[model samples]
Structure formats: structure tokens, C-alpha cells
Target: MTLVLSACSYRYGRVRPYVLRAFSYELPDGLTILLGPNGAGKSTLLKLAAAVVVPQAGRVSYGNLSSRSKEFRREIAWMPQSITPLPSLTAREYVAYVGWLKGLSRTDAWERAQQALRRVELTEQEGVRTTQLSGGQIRRVGVAAALVHDARVLLLDEPTAGMDPRQRRLFRDVLAKLVEDGVQVLLSTHDVADLAEEADHVTVMDRGRVLLSGDTGAFLVEAPEGTAPGRVAEGAYTALLERGEQV
Candidate 1:
């Protein structure tokens, strides 16, 4: 599924400036990293794509599935930066509930929840109450909820925010399996170094505008020569932001 945003515009309030103004881009297949500074409208973009918010103008679609359609909602999942667990629900219950909300039957949701938890390496903690889980564990629960429905597209906002290095690697491995199953992912993050071998494409944004976007290799090529392999993504991203400021 190709998620595309066409001439989209959105804002929090009528008096406030638009967070995304005429934003238009087609999401590339596989995993694409969305990089930008604070208040760059990355979250808003993902929210719109996830259909969590309505676009004030233009359209967001996954091929023939319009954002307004229930099918579109079912085919995509969004994991926000914050995961506030509902009181008293265990991790498995929380995920299963989300699956049900996404249109699954109770029996199916329960079964899928187990599989999802396993994918995020949280099966051992599945019976733990979400409120008692650590920050990173809660984030994994959130990822499990997102995966519970077998969504074709996933929109993640700082999904690895509280994860340690090993946890991040584990999360990336989960993502790799998802991509291999032909799931489209658009992940927003400030951690450029993590994208070295993970990202299939890169899109840089600032102040509601895209500065640069292309395949991972094309994005890396923007950096100056002699850039260390580990620093190439960071270097290219910084250069793009600098050029955007100069524009």
C-alpha cells in the first residue's frame, strides 16, 4: 500500500498557523525515516496520515483507500510518542482491546494480541499491568498494539524514544520482519545515527516544509566527502537543515 498525501493542510486552531501547509508526498515502500527538528510538524503529518485527525484541506490516501474510509483506518496503525496506559489493564488486554477497536472480533483480537506481543519481544511481560511497566516496556506494548491488527502501514512517532541500545536493536529487528512482510512504515525520529542500516528512504522536514527526500543512498550522498560511515546520515541531515535555513 502506497500512502500518499496530496496538497494537505492542517492546524490546531483557526487562529493558529497551519502546521502542515500544502504538504504533499508519497510514502515510499519499506521503512522510511522522517527527520526534523522540534515543532517541524512531523507528528501532525503522521496523525493526518493515521486518520487520527482530519485534514483541513486536501487528501490522505493509501492507494484507493481514502482517509475517510473505515478500510483505510483498519489498514494503518499509529503509535504516538506517548503511551498512557488505561488503568488496570494488563499489557495483553490493552493490545487485544486495541485490536478489537480496529475491527477485530474478541477471539481473533486475543489471539492476535499474543502474536503481536511476541513480535515486540514482550510476551514474557504480557500479563503485567501496563501501569506497572517501565517506560521502555510500555513503548513495546504500544508497538504490540499497533501490530495487533496486522496493519499494512504503520506510522510511528519516536517509537524508540525510551529504549536502550539493545531494546532499540530488538525493535529494529521487529521492524525488519514487518517490512519483509510488505508493511509500509513511516517513522519520525531525531536519531539519525540509528538510520544507517535501517532506513530504506529518508525525508527531511523543517518548519512544515520538506527540505530533502529520496532513497537512503541518495540522502547520504548529500554529505561531504570523508564523512565517517556512522556519521553520514547525521552529516547529510545537518547539511539539509542548514540549506533549508538559508532558503
Candidate 2:
């Protein structure tokens, strides 16, 4: 299914609010990187697409289905930038709980939860209380919860935030596998290095508005004339920051 946003805009409230202006894009079953500076509304846009937030104007639709519809809700899985777990729940229990909420049978929920824990390399930590885990470990548990249902659309906000180099690589590999399986992924990140050779599409946003959106390869190739070839990814990201400042 194609997730399309057409002229969608969002505002927090009437006062001290900035507009996430009308922007349109179609996301297919592959990795699309959402890149932007701090407070650029990357998170807001992801939330809007995931139906966690309503748009003030225009619409976001998945194929022919509106984002607010129950069908759309069932098809999308969202992982926020920072996840705080319930201190009392064990990692395994949390995953199982989310699985059940996603409509899995009790037996099936446990089975899927176990598989997800293994996939995120947290199987050994499953019995540990969420409060006992480190930040990165907790994030892994969050990822596992998102995967337990095998939803078609995955929206992740800074999935690699608290991960170390090894963990980051593991997460990337898992994401690659998901994309290969035809899962549509929309990921927001400040790490430009993570985007190279992974993202098929790129959308750059600044101050709650999209500045540029297109094929990743083309964006890298068309960067400013003085940008170093070997450092295309870094240079392009630097350019984006400069552009953000201009706005």
C-alpha cells in the first residue's frame, strides 16, 4: 500500500504555533529517511502520519483510506523517539502486552513476543524489569514491541538514538530485512551517516516545513558545487543545516 500525504499542514494551537505547511509525498514499500534539524517538526510529521496527531488542514491517506480510519490504524506501527517503559513490567511482559493490544491471541502474543525479543537481540534480557535495563536496551524492547504484530507500515522516530555502533548496525540490518519483505518504513534521524546506502528516498525539513524531498541518490549528486565527493553524505547534511538556519 502507498502512504500519501497531500498538502497536509499542522499547528499545535492558536498561540505560539508554527505551521507544518502543505507538503505532499508518496511513500512506497522501502526505506524513506526523514532528515531535519532540531525542532524541525520531523517528529510532528511522523506523529501526524501515524495518526497520533491530527492535521489542522489538508489530509494524509494510506492508499484510498484516510489516516483516521480503523483500517489505517491497523496497518501502521509507530515507535517514538524516546520510549519510557513502565518500571514494574518485565521486557517480555511489555512485549506481550503490546502484542495483545494489537489483537493477538494470548498464546500467539507470547509466541510473537518471544520472537520479537530474539530479533532485537534482547531475548536474554526479557525477564529483567524495564527499570533495570540501560537506555539502549530499553529502546530495543520498544523496537521489539513494534515488530511483534508484523504491521505493514513502520514509522520510527530516531530508532538508533541510544544505540552503540554495534547495536546501530544490528538495527540497520533488521530494517533492511523489513524493507526487503516489502514493509513501508518512514524513519526520522539526525544521523546522516545512517542514511547512505540504505534510504531510497529522502525528505529534508526545517522549522516545521519541508525544504526538499526527492530520491536520495539524486539529492546527494545535486548537492552544492563545492561539496567534497567523498563526503557527500556529511556535506549534504551540513548544507541542510545551513538551509535550516536561512529559514
Candidate 3:
């Protein structure tokens, strides 16, 4: 299954400039990393894929399913940049609630919530109220919510922003496992050094347009000779943007 965007255009307000203008992309299976600086329209693209916002022109679709279709919505899960705590809900409760919203039965949602929490290594904190958990723990809950419904497509925006090194590694492990299970993941992040190696495909966007996109191996090959191993992806991304600027 793949998510596709075609000639999509969007903006926050009628008078404001467009965040995405005639943007288009087709998601590849496995994990794809979306790299961009802040305000690059990365989040906007994910939101369109997630069906959280409708484009003023063009469309987002999953195969033949339209973005407006309930069936299409059920096939994907989205985790936004910010994970807000539900005032009084425990970690598990919040996840279960999300599953319920996704069309799972209450009983099934509650049971799957446990499994989701476990996948994120948050089983011990399942009963902890969201208000009492630390920021990283709360972000894990957001991920669990997205996983609870067993959706085939996962749209995650800046998922590792608040995570510590260990937590981030654990999150990467979870994503790798999901990909092995045939889940398609499109994750947006600014930390290219941390996730470039994890991607099967890498797409870089700037100023509401795609700068470059291709297989990870091909992208890494763009780095100049003698670039440090640790910064290869970052180097390639920088070189692409710099080249664009010169045009």
C-alpha cells in the first residue's frame, strides 16, 4: 500500500502564502525519511497524507481510495509534531481511546492498547496519568496511539524531537520492526544524522518543494569525498541545498 499526493496546494489562511504549491510525492514501502528545515512544508505534506487537511487543489489517495473516504482514513495512522496530554487519562486509556476512534471495539482497543504500550517499552507506565509522565514518556504514548489500530501506513512528524538518546534508539528499533512487518512509514525529521541510515528512501524538501529524493544508497553517494562517516547524510543534504541555491 502506498500514499500518493498529486498537485497538492495548501496554506493556513486565504491571505497567507501557500505552504505547499503543486507539491506531489508517492510514498515508497518500508521507512522513508523526510528531511527539511523548519517551515519547509514537511509537516504540511504529512498532514495532507494523513487526511488531517484537505488541499485546495489536487488530491491525496491510497491506491483507489480517496483521502475523503472513511476507508482510506482507516488505513493510516498519524502522529503529529506535538503530543498533547489528555487531561486526566492514563497512558493506556489515551491509546485505547485513540483506537476506539479508529473504529476498534472498546474491548479490542483496551487489549491492543497494552500491546502498543509494550511495543514502545511503556508497559510500566501504562497506568501512569499523562500529566504525571515526563515529556519523552508522553511522546512514546503518542507513538503507541498510532500503533494501536494496526494501520498499514504510519505518518509521523518529528517523532524524536523530545526523546533522549536511549529513547530515540528504542523508537528506531520499533520502526524497523514495523517495516519488517510490511508497514509503510513516512517520518519527518530535522535530525538527518540520526535517521538517514534507517531510511529505505530519503526525500528532502525546501521552500515547499522537493529538492531531491531517491534510494538511500544513491543519496549517500552525493556526499563529497572525505566527509565524515557520521555526517554523510547531512553532508549530502547540505550539498543538494547549496546546489539548489546556486541555480
Q: 1-247 in candidate 2: lDDT tens per residue?
A: 6888788888887885755778666775588888877788888888888899988888988888899897787788899988888888999999999999988899999999999898778889999999999887888888789889877888999988868887777778777877887788889987777765468888777777676677788668646778766778777767776876786
List the global CA lDDT of all models.
0.90, 0.82, 0.90
> Per-residue lDDT tens digits of candidate 3, residues 13-85?
9999999998899999989999988888999999999999999999999999999999998888899989999
Distance from true location, Cα of 130 in model 1, Å: 1.7
Query: What TM-score, to 2 decimals, does candidate 2 have?
Result: 0.88
lDDT of 2: 0.82
Q: Which ranges of candidate 3 are over 4 A from the true structure?
A: none
As for candidate 3, its clashing pairs are none
